[model samples]
Target: MLWTITIACLLLAGLIFRQSFRKRNEEIEMAGDAGLAILEFGRAFPGEAIRAVISTANGRTVFLRLHDGKAGCMNAHGHHYSCHLIEPGMVHVTGAGPKRLNVKFSNAAFEGGMFEFRDEKEAAEVSLWLLGSFMPGLAAQNPRIVGQPG
Candidate 1:
């Protein structure tokens, strides 16, 4: 009788283990897909570093750090560079820095994903074509942050 009970317990344990393993595999695959999506967007910065953290709000928060030699609008501008990627409800632009920025969004409420732009040269040459594609209605309402005189 004891031997039969032991065998039943072992079988139950094996089934639980298999289910746990399958769930872990699915989680890993989902993470890999998310990373791939970010990498495709990070291509805009080329060799630059991009990082993301899962936000409490359900949006994957991304921080892009670009270290090219050229000057940037943030440092040169006393006007203070700021942006709101999403409007009043879903995503909030919590912070921005010289090398880092923070954003939070509700995963269920997240309405935006990645930003894709062509290579730098082509993007610069025909920016007018792509101007309204990335962030629509943003520039029109916000005051321009002018750079300080050299």
Candidate 2:
């Protein structure tokens, strides 16, 4: 009788393990698709209009340039994505290499790391986006204030 109960428990554990593996595989398959990333991001932020998308080489992360001059980032997390708006004074960025950037976010929930792009130009562009996030409204508020020596 004890042996029979042990076998049943083992079978149940095996079934649970298999189910978890299947679910993880499904999530992996959904990752790295640009359209899905964009769609998910849109769903998260309905008001933001995406002007451009810069995807990492592995497609795990996507950077967005919004029409209003703000920037955003979407990172795949298991079956879903964590989306965050690059707000002014919320992020710090530095070039780690010719094609990589070391990004640090003030938000504790957001994970920041070294992001590698296809080339130096792409890295520079992302850096600009982070830098621009700090002063997107300044130019529109006072055109003379921009590019003027203090």
Candidate 3:
């Protein structure tokens, strides 16, 4: 009776471990597929490829990519997502910390939403790219303002 009980316990433990491993693999696969879809549909960002992906604990994901030496960002929320060119007037930094960074979008549906990074280094890096490179370039490309006083 003792041997039978021990053997059953071992088998149950092995089964639980296998299940957990499978779940982790599924999550990884989902993330990879999500990244690929973003890349394929990101035609507005010609010649760009996903360089990094940041995921939040609350299930939001952001993709960073570069094209012709400029940076752009894309946001994915669960099964629905959108990509945008980082225009000068579109994004702004709202908060900062060693383990957190907050940015707000002006024209995006995600306006007022804060993007959380794992650490200050990552946050700073992204902020600099957005502010120093992306936004400025976006402004340079903008057409003249319409219909206001000369």
Which candidate gets the maximum TM-score versus the true structure? Answer: 2
TM-score of 1: 0.34
What do the candidate models score in CA lDDT, each in turn?
0.34, 0.82, 0.58
Q: How close is candidate 2 to the true structure, as a TM-score?
A: 0.72
What candidate 2 gets wrong by more than 4 Å, as runs, is 1-29, 142-150
Off by over 4 Å in 3: 1-25, 32-38, 41-44, 47-59, 68-70, 109-112, 138-150
Report the lDDT of model 1 for residue 18. Answer: 100
Candidate 2: Cα lDDT at 114: 88
Q: What is the lDDT of candidate 1?
A: 0.34
Candidates 2 and 3 compared: the better one by lDDT is: 2
**Using lDDT as the measure, what is the rank order of every candidate, best first?**
2, 3, 1
Between candidates 1 and 3, name the one with more favorable lDDT: 3
Order the numbered candidates by TM-score, best leading: 2, 3, 1
Estimated TM-score per prediction?
0.34, 0.72, 0.55
